[model samples]
Target: MNEDERNKNRMSNKVVNYVGFIDAPLNAKDLYPYNSKVGGSPVWMAQPPAKYSHIKCTECSGDMAFLMQLYAPLDHLPQFERSYYLFVCHKCNATRQGWKLIKSMERPRQGYNEYEEEEEEYDEDEEEEEEVQEKVVQNDTKNENGDDDDDWGVEDGDDWGLSGKTDNNNNNNNIDELLMKRDKMLKEEQAKKKEQKNNKQSTSTSSTSTTNTSSTETSPLEGFVTPSDPSNQYKECYVTIEEEVIKQQKMHGGGKGGKHGYVDDHSEMEEWSGESYEYVKDRAFSKFIKRINHYPEQVIRYGFGGEPLCMSQAGNQMFDVKTAYACKRCGKNKVFEFQVVSTIITQISHNKDVSSLDFSNLFALTCPNHCYDVGSDVHNDVIYVEELLLVEKSI
Candidate 1:
């Protein structure tokens, strides 16, 4: 079999099947030894009073899907008590892990009664005495076995002098044969164990040698069509408008500072409301909007799943960008869908108080493969921004 097939076979042999409700919430019935939920709602930070927000995948710029929330509590250190939030973007082969420390309420202590303390001490003493008695009995049995050679003239046999069966010679021969067989079987078992150990040592040595040889070699081709000619493709493209073109184009009043500019009638403006609005309004998208608000000269519009002005876009065309890239490890392409365009960040830096920053548009992408193999550290290979547009506006 091939390397991948061999790996799969080994994994199958080692896998443990668990059947139950995944991502179940902790309740009174489920106390002690907490377990993290998988692929469900995230438990946000409560001590700092933070809201739930989707983290953008670095590779794809798409919103990371919620993977799990781990609840770890410490008795002595309350500050260390935290919930870990894990998210994944399968397309980019990446993971976003975050933690939130929560404050735990002090549990009420039971009354320390003198009588209860006495009873506990008494119970522990009784248990110790019983254990001592058991050890003594075991010692006595060992002594009897050890002294058997002197008493019966045989080292281990139970037939002490053949008391009533002195005349039955056939029975004695049969017992001797049985003892011999038992000893033979035990020796054979020991020999087999030693052989197995030697085999394992040899296998390990061979494997180590093979690994060292393979490490020096380059990685094999993944079979994906990566273009050889670097000059054929450009990383970025730009569009510059002249003063005459701006005057001829139709103007609209929607940008900051009541600026008049050409608006694409075919393009649509998406508005995030309800829970989504609350989640993103305070995060990166909020900062992006504020940056745009400071600039009054440029007008912008959002576009999805198309070429950046002139160059042709690569990859399979789905209904949306969400279902573009699937999981490379488990090969689960249909079950889980990725979050398409949850949030967008313009090239403008929100940290600066300047009038405007460079760039015309921004986009985020995500891994199409979601919730395939839980807890596996598969590659997060989501695609980030491919091409950047440099627009020079002429008034």
Candidate 2:
């Protein structure tokens, strides 16, 4: 559904809405790489990409900084832990290709499939087996050295007792040997049981680690580099998440607000305006202003599996799911994940010069299948998949 249909559905029913706000400037320890004014390293979900091509500026073909990453895991897609990343190339900010938005989700298993984690052979189990073997060898050596107090009860042959009791002595020796063998077998069985118990515990722990973080509890950006830049850095701040229902109702309810329902007036001709008087009457541009003006502070309009707050009237023809946004990995149509609004350009533009980054909005269309390669190690496969990022430039 389009934004109008989505809004109408919410009027009579309860719906959740999300908006991204730049909370504060990054201090020294925020862990995310928000300083890259241009595209920086992606804030990886399952595993950092083997190659850095995702964040490379299409114009410059270079790795740089000023990036924002959102750890917004979807409730519907619970099996997958999701993180959305936005990187703008301020150096090439004048062009539409100057920015790239990425969505990374890690199910640790197939998202839709039942998660039955594979049994694993932990390092500790093997080490315990080695220890048990070493102990058995040590006990055998001690018994051979006449250490009766240690393992077995086979005494020296010198104590055969009386000559008449030779047959009895031989039987006793055989019995002692049999007892020794039984004890060794019992010990080996016990060791095997212990190994099985340890392996069970290890597998259980690994199975529960289905999130982005591994069982080791490593830092979120463990293998990836923490990006930093001073001059060209896009402002990194905590995302102030708010609801549209509260703000929209408060401002417009009881006929308290403006007649246009808090929408912006686009009839005026500004000195900084890039379009002519005729261009101001464009249907696409008018609708774009109406939605954004309602929540002007929102840099992002987030509704997973929802239509984008469309900017251009002719943009939907380009966003054809059957042709343009189809999943190349799973041979299915890509679904709408989220969109980064044009207001985001104001935050990412370096030194307020966004000549190339001039776009109305970016719609992230991801695989409906949530496909990832299931490797040999089912318990620890990481996927870094890139989906379609649709850009709608001003008409």
Candidate 3:
């Protein structure tokens, strides 16, 4: 019948599950079974004319992960094939669902069918004649070898033992010749394989030399060249600014029982002014002077536990800061501390209309066991921006 009738018949015959596990990458043609898994490379079916190009998470401003897709074409609307896509953000509880309609092109004409043609029936007499001819040929070959029952007792000019010896020698000669031919063929094959291998190696060496020459000719700008030594390669440091501040506080007698020790109670803490302000500001600048020179001044925010806060949920409400995970290197959960680099504050205050009175706080979690060495290839720590507000503006 028509496409719709065919689809209905097929659907009635079997139920299709549109869900699949993602273990590897997938493409459009690979989705033919109506349902399949996708990993790494997912086909972006939406064309340029569609509303949105790609999906993004609203909460964390991160790219959304592709979960599943569906394709269905109706008979009446055969020209327009609709595709449904589902995306999810694991860090945040956000779901982005949408669909796109792609215009289907006309299908090409099919070739001829062979099933409609008729076949001739077999003839029993012709088959019997063929079988008799095969038997006659077999008998003639036996006669030439003198293996027939009628010629078994016949007396030749030579002795029967001599005749048997001659036949054995002929068989041995034929076997030797066959073995020699096989050896020759095997040697030729081996030689051909060796030549092919040499050719491949030469081509590969030439290609590698060409690539190296081109790279050298390009003469990449300074600071952009990748280090040839593995030890010099860039790696992430897991150390946080909070841990550094605590260490400095202890070193400068600002820890517990010391004259400049900070109180545990938030209500007892003094406002930023005079000596307190200068101490904090100096500590921040000294700690992050190197980093300030290397990297640009910008706010990088991250979340750890609980549902991620969207733009609406991120107002004045204070949320619990999630505990940082264990050191990925030593697997030890101990010695983890929080610290803040004050250089960022100083840099921002100087650039903006911010006064010393405008207070802001940013903290990072760090491991104490020298786990923050970038050269040793340690895992980077997860740090979050807790607060960034002007006291007067907030009030």
Candidate 4:
């Protein structure tokens, strides 16, 4: 049938119910009599096709039984308040089931006449056996030779009777050997296929179970742990930045505050301008300062939270910043890391609403972990101007 016609026919005669418990028969013929997709699965389940249903005949209730079969959609099933069954009317063949209920009647086997009509012809050997025996007896009577030729028939190796018997035995033996070899090969192939299927099913089930169990008991953020101090005793490898500490050298004259504290006008909090515009004009210069002259800067590593923001006589309070990238749908976090280039005192701007001035620095950030075009935009308030130095070299 054409695709459209097949689909229409299916829609017209489909039958289905919300079956919680299906009592499938053990016999293959009775249970799996129809091919269908159950519960949205492609693999076949034991159920009737969404087509016809058998119903009881109205005329003969119990005796001389007849059945009404319908090829229609299930919408017409009668609803006795909540419960109902649908079937074709045997008398009218209409799409409905009422007093004449649809019975799941057994299919009856066909009689012998239904197979082939004509009888097989009788064998002619029985009718001709008496005449053949009389001829044999007459021929046995010797006319001229005294010796009986009947013994000669048995003695000769090429005797027709003996040859026929020997040929029949040999044919039977050859047939038996051929059948045995065929059966052995078929059994081996079937065994191999069954083993492969079982192994595949087992492997899939095991991997699924393992993955679910592991995900349930593990935490994703347990990978990184930071240390409390900056000693770096526990860390084997670390990246250190050039930091300048004020060294109060003796003036070689009378002084106070531990032989004269280093007095630099820029140290004053109010007089200090923003780090970016005042300090580092170019990223290359900043890198040169870090390498040649020690300058206070940020340092980061695996265990390090991030940049060291402040250090005081009492103690150092560092700000730990961590970024977590994740997929919106799966909630699985992605890994990412970045480096900062140079900072400059580009300019100072006043707050439009407050009429108060604040220093803002634009920082260049690049991701070292990922293979891509790196620089990204970043900004910071009045603080230290830090920049990263990187060069693109073919690897």
Best by TM-score: 2
Model 2 lDDT per residue over 1-395, tens place? 12232223221112255666665654434344222112223434444543443356779976445456665555555565566666666566545566665556555333212212222234544665676556556655554554433333324433434233234445545446545765686668767867886797688657667653444665433334434432234544555555554333225345544432343322322321575545644655665676677778778766666556666654544554445566766777777766778787566544444444566777777776777655621222444555567777655
> Highest lDDT among the candidates is held by which one?
2
Q: Candidate 1, 248: how far from true, in Å?
A: 75
Colliding residue pairs in candidate 3: 241-339, 241-340, 242-338, 242-339, 242-340
- The TM-score values for the models, in the order shown, are 0.21, 0.52, 0.23, 0.17
RMSD, each candidate, Å?
25.5, 17.6, 26.1, 37.8
Q: What 10-residue stretch in candidate 1 is worst by lDDT?
A: 308-317
Candidate number that wins on TM-score, 1 or 4: 1
Residue 223, model 1: lDDT of 13
Q: What TM-score does model 1 achieve against the real structure?
A: 0.21
Q: Residue by residue across 1-395, what tens digits does model 1's lDDT show? A: 13232223121111121111222233422212123333333433221111223355656665544433333222332322222333444344211221121112112112113335546756765675566456445534544454323221334444543343222353345345545654575567656756875796699668867878765432221111112311111111111111111122345567675656443221121222233533533433433343334322322211222222110111111223464433355454332111111111132122223222222221222122222233422222211111111221110
Off by over 4 Å in 4: 1-166, 214-395
Q: Which stretches of candidate 1 lie over 4 Å from their true place?
A: 1-66, 69-169, 210-395
TM-score of 4: 0.17
Give the range of the ten consecutive residues with the poorest summed lDDT in model 2.
111-120
How well is each residue in 1-395 modelled by candidate 3, as lDDT tens digits?
A: 12233244221101121111122233323313223122222232212212223445657755444433322333433333222233334454211121111111122111101111111112433454466456445534554575533222423313233343335454344334434654575567656756875796699668867878755432111111111211111111111111001211222555575556332222111232334544644443433333233333322222111122111112112322343345565665432111112222333211123133222322222232323234532111111111111111111
Candidate order by lDDT, decreasing, is 2, 1, 3, 4
Q: Each candidate's lDDT (Cα)?
A: 0.30, 0.53, 0.30, 0.25
